[model samples]
Target: MRRVAMMRATFPDALVTGHEPLIPAMTNDPKDRHVLAAAVRADAAVIVTTNLKDFPSAALAPYDIDAVSPDDFLLNQLELNRIATLTCVVDMAHARNRPPVRPVELLDRFSVIAPQFAEEAKAQILNQSEPSPWLIHQRREID
Candidate 1:
């Protein structure tokens, strides 16, 4: 797409490397150990991962970090803020008009990844319990 033609490779502001030695022995997967170690280095509370089995709770509990699938993460976020989450999804759907995706169709695709989130979001939307767009709180001013 023309929008992405000149885009540079993106990276997080913080970079963690050479964390192999910091990895816990309980993190059995040699390939993914560095990911946990990097999380520890970055002091992240959660690791959004599709490979949860590789980062079991037993290994992550000591580091006070959690490994969750993208779906589970989205579900947890939806639970925390249904209005904002749905609003975001709706906005994204609207923005994707070139391909012409409906909000429900987008939600349907989300259902494949996060069934619980999709179900709960649908229920909330259909019930009209979510506040209007204007009701969402303003972003907090950064210090």
Candidate 2:
């Protein structure tokens, strides 16, 4: 709830409510129904979640939505925009100022949560030479 509150605070207009009207028993798990309801309400293109089994492609295909694991999602982002993704990861590492996390340490942490994404990201970061348009835009926005 605290993290939700922080996200709400950060992106006030991005958060959607009134999902109750869209509620349906889309999944076997009652607890996961809310996730489907929210996606329906928002008309999301994709639902990024670790629990891919709960959101089978057959179930989401009807709604023109696909459920993707966080690993796959991050890997897609890394492949599409390697420079921006690498910059984001490096920025995240620097943000852990309490212990001053190194980029390798951050990648190591990601290995536990999303091993495929961590491996791909590390490879992309090491091989990438040119800055992506996304990274250039992000830097401009920050500056």
Best by lDDT: 2
Worst 10 residues of 1 by lDDT: 134-143
Off by over 4 Å in 1: 1-26, 129-143
Instruction: Give the Å error, residue 114, model 2.
Output: 1.2
RMSD in Å for all candidates: 6.7, 4.7
TM-score of each: 0.69, 0.79
TM-score of 1: 0.69
As a whole number from 0 to 100, the lDDT of residue 94 in candidate 1 is 71
| Candidate that scores best on TM-score | 2
Q: For each candidate, how many residue pairs have backbone atoms clashing (under 3 Å)?
A: 0, 0
Model 2, which residues run further than 4 Å from truth?
25-28, 127-143
What do the candidate models score in CA lDDT, each in turn?
0.71, 0.75
Worst 10 residues of 2 by lDDT: 134-143
